[model samples]
Target: MHKSFSLQMGDKTLELGPKPLVMGILNATPDSFSDGGDHNHVADAVAQATRMVEAGADIIDVGGESTRPGANEVGAQVELDRVMPVLDALQEAKIGKPVSIDTYKAVVGHQAIQAGATIINDVWGFQRDPELADVAAHYNTPSILMHWDPNRDTSKDIVSEMKRYFNKSVQIAEDAGLIKGQILLDPGFGFGKNYEENFTLLNRIDEICALGYPVLVGFSRKSSLGKLLGVEPKERVAATGATTLLAYTKGAHIFRVHDVRENYDALQVAHATIYGPPPAKDI
Candidate 1:
């Protein structure tokens, strides 16, 4: 896999060196599928974010809306209200880490960048709102395009469709004035995949990673794990850790996860076993 990668958002810069990155999930929503309503308040959000960073998070991803199955949609203002306080609190606390705004709305993303977010992680992969590509370009923030479609057709090959979507997403970003290096691709595990397809994507992640872009995979507490192990979201941490190790060895550059320390620890061992020893500070 090609190694050079860099991203800039607000005043923060993220460079993917040798080891994979641990992006801690900070859902500031009331109804996330996993860990929802856990960090809705400012105090709770800050506390959780602090714990994540202390536990070895390289980045904090804050999302205001819950995209869980059968969840209600929140308005932009509500999302803004839910997210700004936490982002502001994190900035004020001086965590010295890059903050990622997990939203597809351009206005919400704009407000997030104004409040100190450096990354835009859109689960729709810019297929929802083409204007979101413009927002990422406007702010010059690094963009993560995760494969997702509520009505995705399962008849076709999922990985090939994901590659097609990435190609289109890259075009959208470039057309909107965003550079290729500023873009990252995500297969979006458990978003629109079936039990077998999720693992198929995982097994072929290295092929996707070989397409010449940084790959970010989110298998943490996903329903696919539950489908495989007959466990619930909270019980999927060990499964998530296993997936993390597998994804890392397959050349995934980032792991968006709920349990930062466990994933970080697993990646530490993976790095040692495969890529050599990481620095004490990195683990």
Candidate 2:
């Protein structure tokens, strides 16, 4: 297993796999499903970003559009307008953590990088906008490529599908001149899979992680969790925590989540019990 790896962006390095890195999700859109319209305002967005960072997040994933099911498509300009203020504010305030822009549009991703985002998180796995990969290459920005098939295929084994999906994403990145080390793979928890498929993907996350790329699990308040527990997305913190622990043990290197503090605390205990003590001089 690739137990340890780090992605460098300027002077910052995000170490992975010693324990799962917490990537707090900050959607500055009006329909992000969970925090939709909550942080649409600049001040609210900045404050929430600060709060999540202070609560022990390793990264802040800021999105301008909502990827919730049935969500309407947003233009690049609309997306940019929604997220720029938040990005600018965070940059001005020096949030002290790498900010990842969650966008699949090339123009938006490029602008976000120029505005100070360190990583590009494309939920379409680099397929929706081929230019998105080019943006990453141009900026040499680290990327999180999520496994998303618009078809939502549930007929096959999801883990195998994930491998195929990631393989394609890697090729797309490479074809655009993005290096292997600059790419991270996400299982796309609730993106295209059904309830059973999501859990199955979680249960066999090791196969996905075995791809030798850092594996990021974004199962925070996902619809799959809500459906399984019969709770709403906002009411699924406990369920999210439970999945966080499971994903941690299966070699998930990063968690794209909403409840940062709870996942941080859960991982600390799991890290201690499963991975044992930290290095004598390490935190």
Candidate 3:
């Protein structure tokens, strides 16, 4: 229903909806579930981001906070310290790809946009702080509005509830003077829901995609995948690839993942299957 859309960052315009785009994850947090603490420094962050770009990432998502379930929240200043230097380094390095800052704090979001982040991947889905919406609007940064039910310690009709949550958040974002082109929707697969809830949402992804915005599906090494496949975090690569392929089939325009190459390959196969072979090019 989005009628085919794309996001413009710098001189590049990334096509979305008609096919899936890979959003490689680069976590600078010391405790991220995957590759955490490994890229905490600015140099390492730049290297990791560069590697992802080489692996065919359409967008690089950089996060300083570990949003793993039950992770203790860090202060805004700490988050800023963790992310800004890497952001500065990435810009200085002339990274060609658009960078997306993964944060839920308004101050961090504001500074990240100033630091050259063109996208805001808010895990809280604009529910954590009222100021976040204002920050996003102030910068006019393209934001990924994920489905997060702020109903703590409750798990009732999660899929339906999340749909409602996304609708309200979308409305609020629109009211904040954010253009439709600047908004993308994410289902927040493991944010506040149980395993069953996650699958139900996954099976019905089109319901969310029908909201008339680009859909971002992120389930990389998530506990829900582990629970379903009975595997550990390190063993979720194959499952992650499968999920990315499924999401592509279900109209997902973007995939946030740790293994960029695997998802990139999986997307190629999915695209070929869905739309026949690519046109022949002059070598």
Worst 10 residues of 3 by lDDT: 150-159
RMSD of each: 2.0, 2.2, 2.2
Whichever of 2 and 3 has more lDDT, that candidate is 2
Taking the tens digit of each residue's C-alpha lDDT, what string does model 1 give over 1-283? 4376877655556888567799999999988998888889999999999999999999999999998888998889999999999999999998878899999898999898889988999988887788889989998889999888656567888877788878888898899998887999999888877889999989998888888888898999999899888998999999999999888877888999999999999888887877667466744
Compared with the true structure, model 1 gives a TM-score of: 0.95
TM-scores, all models, native as reference: 0.95, 0.95, 0.93
Off by over 4 Å in 2: 278-283
Per-candidate local distance difference test: 0.88, 0.88, 0.84
What is candidate 2's lDDT per residue for 84-168, written digit by digit as tens? 9999999998999999999999999989998999999999989999889999998888999998896746677777777887888
Clashing pairs in 1: 9-118
- Which wins on TM-score, candidate 1 or candidate 3? 1
Which residues of candidate 3, in runs, are more than 4 Å off?
1-3, 10-12, 150-156, 279-283
| Model 2 TM-score, 2 decimals | 0.95
